[model samples]
Target: MKKPKTTNRYCKFCKKRTSQKLAAVKTGTPSSLKRGSKYRMRKRGLNRGFGNKGKTSRGALGSWKRYGVKGSKKISLKYTCGDCKKVGLSANTIRSKKLQFE
Candidate 1:
């Protein structure tokens, strides 16, 4: 949380104090590559009619190996407007573990 190279703030299309330029809005999807437990597999059907095969979830005692992606990557802040150049987004949402805009 260190984004203050410029933040006079109030730039509703340059209506007042403008000089905002700190950005870091990296919003979603970055956890290596989500979903691949084979749809929690378990599909060996039609043994005497057709055919189908899939397997993965071995829970209850294996707990399905506890998959991945508990949810992450949600940081925001992209306020450009240096004078009606317009671009805003840092109204409210300030979770921080890291975010430094120099």
Candidate 2:
């Protein structure tokens, strides 16, 4: 879907309608040093020598292709208020295969 680069929207910070810049909010990257990742590494026997690490040792139960996946993702919009210079996120989310800012 295509959207305008800027639009007039109600800004909570400004307490009035203002010209806002539109941008797509992207998902951030996960850090491998996190606790969950560390535990997964240990279970997968990627850390040290192991005899039998059980079911999780194989990592995933099946190939990624076997699991049903969604073609699109829920994307939210970020609005930068022209008056207050504060950032705000849209309450509603849009599900689309591709989002373009025009």
Top candidate when judged by lDDT against the true structure: 2
Which tens-of-lDDT digit does each residue in 1-52 have in candidate 1?
Answer: 6777677878876578877787777645334323443322322233335433
TM-scores, each model vs. reference: 0.26, 0.68
Question: Candidate 1: global Cα-lDDT?
Answer: 0.60
Residues 1-102 of candidate 2: C-alpha lDDT, one tens digit per residue: 999999999998888999999999978855565544535545556556754344344535324323346788789999999888899999999999999888
Q: How many backbone clashes does candidate 1 have?
A: 0
Q: Which RMSD values do the candidates have, in order?
A: 9.8, 4.8
Candidate 1's C-alpha runs over 4 A off are 5-18, 21-76, 88-102
